[model samples]
Target: MWQPFEYAPKNKIIFGKNSLARLGEITEQFTVKRVAIVTDQGIIDTGHVEKAAYYLTQKNITTYTFSDFAQNPTTENVTAGVDFAKEHQIELIIGLGGGSSMDCAKGVNFLLTNGGEMQDYWGYGKAKQKMLPMIGIPTTTGTGSEAQSYALISDSKTHRKMACGDPKASFRVAILDPSLTVTQPTSVMKATGIDAISHAIESAVTKRRNALSASFSLYAWKLLNANFESMLFSPENEEANMGMQMGACYSGMAIENSMLGATHACANPLTKNYGITHGHAIALMLPHVIRYNADHAQDIYEDLCRISGIVIASCAGKALARRIEKIVAATELPTTLSAYGITADAINNLAVEANEEWTAQFNPRIVKYNDFVSLYNKAL
Candidate 1:
């Protein structure tokens, strides 16, 4: 039986090498005046901010820069950004880095235009006012925030990640320039690449998965699996870089159509409790979650394994789990929670937090706190 679904595609994506050239024209289409570019200090240090600013300068567009958000942005960060944008009377926004920068831009947009606390808009489509138009240029291939309507912000008070979303929050345009990603250091590359791969894998069997969304995840899997190694081992491989970016973007699209699963559900508690980088936390937990889901979701996993041209070792679900662990290890990222010094005592608390995360509800299989506890122990 076919499941009912809804699809509303909102993003206009411009992809290629040096696609950043179109920023001025895109902003002109929106009649942008003064603009704010939201990103991190790393991007400015790497000269991407200057490069983007130069393009705006060519068209006589004035700009403000905000790089004040954390890796997992906080409500305070968005509040500060909204104040900055308001003080400057910025007319348009550009997010010019990884997920953090893009998400921060969306966070700012919510409070700047809508005039409310971040908590007021914690779920989907809560904004009742017009949103300032924004463009997202991903300097790294992770997070896929550019392609989705949700902003993952952390509550400064609770330290819990919040999924604040609205149609208005989705980027007006997403610029995927492969050249921009090639300059990232190996650590950034590995971490973000794993995140993209996880999106491709996890979104495939979520309860919300539909045929259209599944197509995106499956193709994303093929691209990421095929290109990930080349992008890592062969520095500046333009073709490989393009594949990874496209894969990540498609995976983002899948996330928009469906949602993530228990891997993310299990991953979040690690980040919340241990201050682990989101990517590494996800990498540590995903293999175990994959194995856990496979008891019911094996066909989906095997299909992806086959489509990605990976050998399903002995035609068993456990092989797929081991393969995921191998990929994480090959990236040289930690594959165990213990690597980060998280002790057994942490599992009980982490599982409780995981149980509360909304993404766990979307897992293809039913997940409970006990299931999270088991998954965390296996990850350890």
Candidate 2:
């Protein structure tokens, strides 16, 4: 029997090369006089921010820029953005960068309109007031923040990742312009690509998986699996870039309905403690988690393998695990926990934190502290 699931997508997604040209017209629909463009300095350097500003300015919409945020986007960053928005009396927000920018935008929207701290809206649907309208233009093919309602903001003091979400937080428009992503550095491409691939795999067989989510995940995996190598090999491959972009967006849609699984649960502690990039950490843990969940998600894993045309080695789970491992190896990202200086002594502590991650309970297979310990050991 299929699991019952709700599907209410609030974001309007426009996809194509140079689709960003529509930004001014889309913002005009909201009839907003002032808009805030939330992004990082790196994106500003890429000139995407300037381009976005030009579009909005053509419509006579004044644009305010906020780039004071780190890669992980701490809660403090959101506060700063909110303060900036307040000063400008921002009528609408535009997130023009990668996931961090989009997440920071949503985080600002949550606190700016609702009048509270980031922690107050940590889980989901905590905001009672209406949020300001927002647009998201992803310059990277990962995180898929444009297609979803959750903001993964971290606590500045404690450094814990918090997922803040609300229906109002969803973007009013998402522009997937493949032209924007091709300029990303090779390192960023590899890390974010792996992260997008992980999203598809992890969301496919979560405890919350449903027919709707399954469809998205399956197609996302197919596109991501087929195009990831091409994108990495030739960053200027527009067709490959488009495939990866849509794949990442579809993965985000899947995650909206099904959530994630043990890979994310295990990867979080690594990122929190070692400052490992989220995608690199995910690369280290995903294969191990895939093997661990084999007993419960074997059929799902097999389906993924068949769809991706991977030869089943021993079983579907193993084949899928090997495929992921091969992809990580190709990227030259570290595949073992020890490669990041994570020692066996750290396993117990890491496992404890992993067991407490919000996604742990959503794994198709139960992941207890001991199980996390074992998974970490295997990765090591």
Candidate 3:
């Protein structure tokens, strides 16, 4: 029997090679005068923010810049953005960067509208007031934050990243311009590209997955899994970059409909403890998680192997895991916990946190603290 499911979509997406050119026109759709451009210094330094600002400026729109957020946006970051928005009396916002910039934009929306802090809206559907209409302009092919409603803001004291979300907080429009991603550094491409792949694989077998979410996941898998090798070497290829952007965004849609699983559950603990990048953390543990979830999700794994043309090395799950491990290696990222300098003694502590993560509950195979402990050991 099929489980009953519901899908809710809020954002209107505009995707193409030069979608950023329509920024000014998109802003005109909403009745707003002052607009806040929420981004990070890295994006500003790249001149992408200025390029986006030009479009709005041409339409005689006043724009205020707020670029104080970190790569992993924190409560403090969102708070500062709220202050900026309040001071500027921003009637709208434009998120023009990668996941960090877009996530901060959603975070800013949470507090600016609801009269509370980021931590207050930590769960889901917590907003009460209508948020400022905003446009998302993603400059990378990772995280797919543009396609989702949740803002992953880190707690100031505990450092636990909160998935703060509300339908109102979702971007009114997402403009995916592949040309913007061409400027991304090779390291950024690897981290974000792998993150998309993780989303593709994890969403397919998650307990909350439905037909809609599975289709998005498989489509994402097909786009990204097939191009990993070529994209790594030909990062500047226009077609490959376009496919990766769509792949990441499609996986984000899957996450929007369903949710992630143990790889995310394990990765969060690694990020909090080791200060490792989120993509690197997940890439290290995802292969191990595939093996962990394999017995229960064999059909799902086999489906990915078939659709993505992954060669099976005797076992559906193990083969998929091995294939992914090789792909991660192509990025030259650290794939083992030991390589990251994490000690054997820390597995218990890490497992405790991993087990407590909300995503852990959705793992197709029930995840216990011991399972996490063992998985971390294998990654080591």
Candidate 4:
């Protein structure tokens, strides 16, 4: 029998070329007067924060913006955001950038309402109190943070990334304005796109995957694989941008239901140790993880290939891995771990850390320390 699963979508998604104009209208639904927009310096530079503030202010809502977080949001950053929100007595929050901004927003909500450190809610559903209603407006086409309840916050001291989640933390609305993504640099586009693609593929065959997540994963893979190259080559194409945005959102939704696998588990340590960008680290590890999981998830891998119109070669897993390699090649990112200056000696430590990542347990195929070591060596 199929595993029993609950399919409840908490976020109402609005997708268009310029749905950002509806931000004020959407905020009004919560009947909140004081609002906080959590974003990044880069997005503020792009004027999206100003545009969002203008819309909210026009509706007679008092607006505040917090952009003190780094690209990988830390617990200290969330604490700082909480202090800022407390000072202003903010009513509602709008996450208005990439994953970092959204995650920082969620992390703030966790503490703003339910007073505690990020580590208190490390696993899931640990918040004992209600969380403030928040909206996610993504300016990038990846990370799918808009569609998730979890906030990936790094610990300040140890630099460990924590996935803190609760039902109350899910976004009330996700505004997908493809136009916002056009302003990103080409390198950002390539990295985030690859990250989204990994989300779709990894979520598809995880141990937690069920019917609901499977549908999302398959469709997201189709959209992402079909449009990734176009989004890179013709960044201004509305159709391509929309496809990538929706694909990334769907990938996030899939992750919400199913979680991820060894690729993310392996990628996290690379980001923490070497400061490798998340997407670039994912690119280096994903193909190897796919091949590793083939013994148990080959059928699922084959399904992804079939849906994306990729003909399987001798092995479905190998074919999918090769396809991902080809997609990575299209970008300027290096495919090998050594290219990032990650030496062979570091593989042992990276493997140990990878084995301990939260996503490691959910990998369809069991991943041990030695297995991670092998995967790292292969990537090297």
TM-score of each: 0.98, 0.99, 0.98, 0.99
* Model 3 error, position 39 (Å): 1.3
Residues 75-117 of candidate 2: C-alpha lDDT, one tens digit per residue: 8998999889999999999999889999999999999999879
Cα deviation in Å at residue 357, candidate 4?
0.7
Per-model CA lDDT versus the true structure:
0.89, 0.93, 0.90, 0.94
Which residue window of length 10 is worst by lDDT in model 1?
A: 308-317
User: Cα lDDT for residue 1, model 3?
Assistant: 47
Better of 1 and 3 by lDDT: 3
State the lDDT at 58 in candidate 3. Answer: 88
Residues 1-380 of candidate 3: C-alpha lDDT, one tens digit per residue = 48789887889999998888999888987967799998878788888888888998888889999998888988998899999999999999888888999999999888888887787898899898888898888888889889899899899889998998888988989999999888888999999999999999999999999999999999999999877667789978988998999999999999998899999999999999899999899899999999998999999899999998887877899999998899998999988899889999999999999999999999999999999999999999
Best by lDDT: 4
The alpha-carbon lDDT assigned to residue 140 of candidate 2 equals 91
Measured with C-alpha atoms, the lDDT of residue 232 in candidate 4 is 95
Off by over 4 Å in 1: 313-316
**Candidate 1 lDDT score at position 188:** 84
Would you list the clashing residue pairs of candidate 2?
none
C-alpha lDDT (0 to 100) for residue 42 of candidate 1:
88
Error of 3 at 17 (Å): 0.5
